[model samples]
Target: MVLVISVTVSFFWLWFIKRFETSTRLTGKPSVIFSLFLCGIGSVFAALFLAELEELLLSHVAFLSPLTYYVFYVGLCEEFGKFLVFYLAASLTDMTKEPKDGLLQAAAVALGFAILENILYSDWGLGILLLRSVMATTGHMSFAVIWGYAAGLYLYSKRAGKNKYSFGMVIGAVCTAAVFHGLYDYFLGMDLKPISFLLDAIVLSISVYILRSLKGRSPYESGDKEAVAEAIESNSNNFHLNRLAGVQALKTRDFETAAKYFKKASTVNHREISTKVCLLFTELLTGSVEEFEAYRTLDRICSSINVSNLNRLRARIAEVFAGCPDEERLLNLIDDLIDETGYRELLKERIAQFDKYANAIAGKGCADSGFLISDKNSLPMAYRHPSFYTKENNE
Candidate 1:
C-alpha cells in the first residue's frame, strides 16, 4: 500500500510537469522522454556518490555545524547532481530549442529526481510521503525552474545572435538555484516551522514569477495558424529555423525566396517588428517600391511600433534612397516621415546631406569629386546619378 501510494504521488507530479511540455508541443519527441528517464537514473547514482564523498570528507573535520552540512554537503550535492543532468540534457538534445522547452525539460528532470528520492524515503510512513510529495517534490520543481529559465534565456539569446551575456546568465542561474536549495534545506534542517515557511513562500513566489515571465516571452505563443500549418508541413515549427532560412536566402541574393520566408515569419508573430523589417527590406531590394511603401506606412500608423524600430526603418530607407536616385519616392517617404512621427529633424538632416552631395556632383562634373561617389571604405555608398559618371567621362 505504501509503495502504491508513493508511486501514485510520484506519477501525479510527473503528469503535472509533463503538462507544460505538452502545451509547448515538446511531447512529440520520444528522445526527450528518454533523456528525462536517463537523468532520473543518473541522479540516483549521483546521490550515492555524493553520500560516500561527504562521509569521507566530513569525517576528517574537527567540528561541522548542521547549517554548514546542510548547505554544503546536502544542498550543494543534491542541486549539483540535478544541475549536471539538466545541463547534459540541454547540451545533448536538439529538442531544447526554446525557453519553454528548457523549463519543461528541467522540470521533467526534477520530477525524475524527486521520484527516486520518494522511493528512497517510502518506508518513512504515509505522513512523510504526503509531506515529501507536497514540499520536497514541489521544492525541487521550483528550484529547477530558476536555472531552467536562465538556460532558456541563454538559448533564446544565442538564437537571436545576441549571446554576449549568455555564459554569465547560465552561471548566475546555477549559483542562484544552488543557494536557494541550500537555504531551503538549511531552514528545514533547523526544524523551525516559521523560518521554513518563510523560505518556502519566497521560493514559491520566485518560481511563479519566472514561469509567468517565460510564458510571456515564449516564441510558440505567436505566428499565424496558416504559417504554423506550413511549418508543420515542413516538419519544423522552429522560429529560429525559419529565420535562418530567410537569412540564407537573403545572403544568396534570392530576394523572392527570402521575402517568402520573411513574410511567413512575419505572420508567425504580428508583433515581431524585426521580421516585418526584414520583409520590408527584402521588398525594397526586389524593387517592389509599392509594397515597401505600404508596409512602411502601415508600420508608421501602428502605435505598437516603438521608436527604436521606427529609427531602424528610417535608416534602411535612407540607405535605399542614397544608393538609388528616385527623387519622387524619396520625396514621398520624407513627406510620410514628416507627417507621421517626431523624426522630422533627423529626416531633414539626411535630406540636407543628400542634396549637398547631389549639388557637389552636378557642379563639379566629376565622378570622384562628390560624396555620392562610392568608396570601398564608405558604407551605404551614397547615391550617384547613373548618367553623372558617364557625362563626366565624356567631358
Candidate 2:
C-alpha cells in the first residue's frame, strides 16, 4: 500500500513541479534539474527516517509520550536535515540566483519526503494514498516552503549585507515548523476525535500564515520598475520636462539642438547636479565655450552648483576640440565624466538615441529599426521646441 502511494505521489509532485518551473518562463536547464535533484534527495532521507524510526526517536529524544516533544523532535530533525541538503545543493549548483527559485527548490525537497513517507506507512491503501497525497503532501510542501522562503531571504539579506540577525531566522523557522507538525500529529494521534477538527483548523491557519509571509517577504520585490515610475509620477508637479528634453537631445547626437534645450532649461530652473553638468556639456559641444562665462553675470542659473572640476574639464575638452577638431578627445572626456560620477541620465540618453536614429555614434551596431525608435519621433520635437529649448527668454 505504501509503495503504491509513494509511486503515485512522487509522479504527481514531479509533474506539478515540471509545470510550475516551466510556467515561470525561465530558460536555464541547470536550475530546473537541480531542483528535481533536491526533491529526490529529500525523499530518500525521509524514507531512511521512516525505516529507522526507533533509532530516530531515540536520537530525537522522542519517547512517544508527551507527544508535543515528539513532534518537536521530528520537526527539528527534518528541518535541519532539509537545510543541510539545501545548503549542499546550493553549494554544488549555480541555479540559485533569484529568491523565488530557492523556495521552489525547497518545495521539491519537501514533496519528495512526503511521497516517500506515504509509501512506507504499512496500513495505507489506495484510499489512504489519496488522502496522504493531498493532506500529507500539502503539509510537507508547506513545511518546506517555510524554510525555502527563509533560504531565499537569507541569501538576499547576505547579498545586501543586511542580515546580521540571520541565525535567529533558522531557529524561528524550525520552531514554527515544530509547532505546526505538533498540532497536526496531536490531532491525528487523537484518531479523528471531534475536537481534532479545531486543532486541524489551527494547523491550517498556521500553515497559511507561514506561506503568506514567504509570499510577501521574498528578497527581491518583483515590481521595482513600476514602483519607480509611480514615484516619478507622484513628484511630477516638481519635475521639469524641458530639462529632460535637453538630456534627450544630447543623447541623440543633436549637439546644436541639445545646446538650445539645455540653455532654456538652465535659465528657467533646476536642482539636480546632474542637470547642471549635462547643460555644460551641451553648451561645450555646440562650440559655445564663451557662453560658459555668461554665468558670472547672474547670481546662479541652475540649482546644482557645478562640481569643482566639472566645468574645468569641460573647458579643457573644448580646447581639445578647438586645437585639433578631434571628436575622439572630447568623447573620451565625456565618457570619463560619466564613469567618475556614475550618472545614468547621460548613458540612458545615449542608449535611447542609438535606439532611435541608428545614426548617432552610439547607434552604429543596432540592427532592428522597430526596436530603435518609434515612428512618432517625440524626442526630436521635444528638444527643439522653443518652450523647451530657448532658456534665455524664460530667465
User: Among these predicted structures, which one has the highest TM-score?
Assistant: 1
Model 2, position 330: C-alpha lDDT score: 49
Q: Mind giving the per-residue lDDT tens digits that candidate 2 earns over 1-395?
A: 54665656666765654444421342224446435544545655753564367465568563556575447555566666666677667657554444555667776777666666676653656766666666766666666666676776576445434563485785587567756656665666667634544554555466457545544532223223332233223222222444444444554577776566556555555544444555665665565754335333221432223334455555644542343334564455554543433333343454455545554423333445334333434348544343342224324
Count of backbone clashes, every candidate in sequence:
1, 3
What are the per-residue Cα lDDT tens digits for candidate 1 across 351-391?
A: 56665665555544334433443432243333333222222
Question: What is candidate 2's TM-score against the reference?
Answer: 0.47
lDDT of each: 0.62, 0.53
Between which residue pairs do clashes occur in model 1? Answer: 223-268
Off by over 4 Å in 1: 2-5, 22-34, 54-59, 156-162, 166-168, 223-258, 262-395
